[model samples]
Target: MSHFSGIWIPIITPFDGGAIDHGALHGLVRQYVEAGVSGFVALGTTGEPAALNEQEQGAVLDTILSAAAGLPVVAGVGGNHVESVLERISLLNHKPIAGILVAAPYYVRPAQVGIVDYFKAVADQSRVPVILYDIPARTGVHLELDTLLELAGHERIVAVKDCGGSLDKSLSLILDGRLQVLCGEDLDMFGALCAGAHGAISASAHLMPERFVAMAKALEEGRLSTARQLWHSLVPIVHAAFAEPNPGPIKAALSQCGRIRNELRAPMTAASDDLAARWTLILNKVVGSPAGLEQS
Candidate 1:
């Protein structure tokens, strides 16, 4: 199996009123690839897959896969409906995607056995490799380590984006040559690295790809202190992006840098004015000269 290491970005989709903005999406893809990103995760949590219609998901997958060139594209969202999820797997199987990033069912709250069966069913049908997504904080259900180990033994199950936010649980899975764990939390990145994770599926890389890449390299090279310092500098940005709903602070920062417009779908709102202002202040404190900030 091919390796998936380094900084993989969970990209946020750019939308122009319920429709995928191909231009903006393509531009972001090119920009990220140029910025030294190792892989692309289109339609993941950051991409707002829940908000996207099937047609939009297909379109974004096509555009992102084509734009990503040879870099790996992890087409996201296997959705909740088992039938729908299987259908998504079929579609992704035919695409140029390197793997499928499947999050747990939101609001359904299935049992552990159900969770295991859900992935097994999808993996049985999936043509490409499957990267199990375990972001319990978001999905309200955690794919227990035993379930993951069982699924990892499957023929097509390849890797995972471990967002459970538990280093202990993540570590347990990685011990004894289990699944390859890609640290899923932004703030705990350095810690995850210390705990033996392969790499990260980081959302912050959308804003600072090259730097995140450098940190990964630094850690790989045994420059622990250097990597920690770089990781520390990003805490403010991380805190800000998460202070509000995700892509909100990120979109605001992206717009401030001119990557995308500060627009979000309903049920998802923009950052409060006071929060936006705080993000600006935080950016100024860390960014110094808008060096990494995008401008129109």
Candidate 2:
């Protein structure tokens, strides 16, 4: 089966004047592709899928797929409603996507058994493979190791985006060698890669995708020193991206580079003046360098 195993950028949906900015979105996708990222994840958490209406979400994904230029794109399929989520997956199955990234049911925090059942059912109906998204911080429930092991038995349940925040669980999954373990925690990406993770589904990679790709390559080639150097430099930028609830800081940094307008939907405003200022310097240091990545 095809498995994802490199730096994948979960793109933030760029907005302008309360509408999806297709022009900017396409530009962002083309930029990342040229930067040598392994793949792309559209409508993921960082994309602010929650803020987008159903039609808008479909349009955004369509734009991303078109702009990706045949690169692998994983569509995020997640929701608390099982029937609705299944229907969504069914529709997505017809799309020319690499896989579907599904998170555990959020807010409801279903029991472990229910979690397993939910994934199995989704996997059963999905025409494409499934990349389990285990981000408990947003989902409010852990897809515990046991549950994952059970799901790993399924043919279509191929890989995982490990963001549950349990080091022990992460190590166990990596050691199991059944499911391809892709780190979802940006800050822990270097460590996870060192521990044999397949790759990362990184939001921060949206900034300097080549650096993230180079770091993954370094680790794969057993160039620990080189990977460590890249990781150290990326630490601050990753931290800054999350300083104000996600895409805000990311958009702010992108705006400074004239990539996007740094706008977000209601209830999710742009980054603070202070955080935007801080990201400017951080991005400047990371953007153009002898290390990796070109300034666009």
Candidate 3:
């Protein structure tokens, strides 16, 4: 029943020759839309928002919104500065986004109560729904169980992108039933879904989105045997996608498929030659397999 309940791509911001490749970005969104992704998360971690300036981020989101053709888009808003984050949320409120994904303040490592206050403030400011992004690995501040439960009381804070890396905590959130849980860790997608997570925001799904959508649908429909087969088949590609610090291997695979150029910004390089080769071989096997070709 939740609109967030399915495979959502935290889309990569494609680049070509040191510029934001709007054409490639548009094409990627169209490709995933056709692939039956539930929606997209523009400017999320995968999109490299930290590398782009305000103008570039806005342009990228505009292109994705246009290409989405009415599919829901959740814009990513993150920062340690409360006022700045709220300002970003206010700006996004004018856009046609389904929600905002707000991560905990990074580098500051605020206390749990501070985390609660921050999200509460963000939820209060956001006109659109808010999906809490609980990626402690990146933020260095974990959204402890009690903090999350407290935040769930906010009407606007509708869901969580669960990347806390604690299965017990993730399961607890699902069992609580107040906030919809979307698996943010690609490798745990299956287990999370089996535990009743609403869906996933997968980076690897950029490669075989339809397959991911199918797996989610199968699980939702109670087709356990089919979902198991799909998950088993996807494990290798998932591993390959995250093999080299995100977006690199993902960009390489997309480039190999002729979707986008294998380019990344400064500080984030392209996938290594060896990793690219391995990715090609793995992609070939997966895409060529009957499971990959099967329609949902």
The prediction achieving the highest lDDT against the true structure is: 3
Model 1 ranges with Cα > 4 A deviation: none
Model 2 earns a TM-score of 0.96
Instruction: List model 3 lDDT by residue over 1-296, tens digit each.
Output: 23688999999998888899999899889888999999999999999999999999999999999999889999999998999999998899899899999999999999998999999999999899999999989999999999999998898998999999999999899999999999999999999999999999999998778888899999999999999999999999899999988889888888877777888997998999999889767876888732343321
Cα deviation of 177 in candidate 1 (Å)? 2.3
Candidate 2 regions exceeding 4 Å error are 288-296
Cα RMSD to the true fold for all candidates: 1.8, 2.0, 2.3
Of 1 and 2, the candidate ranking higher by lDDT:
2
After superposing candidate 3 on the true structure, give the runs of residues whose Cα lies further than 4 Å from its correct spot: 289-296
Instruction: Tell me each candidate's TM-score.
Output: 0.94, 0.96, 0.96
Q: Rank the candidates by lDDT, best first.
A: 3, 2, 1
Candidate 1, residue 166: how far the Cα is off, in Å: 2.3
**In model 2, how large is the Cα lDDT of residue 19?**
89
Taking the tens digit of each residue's C-alpha lDDT, what string does model 1 give over 154-180? 887888898887667788877845577
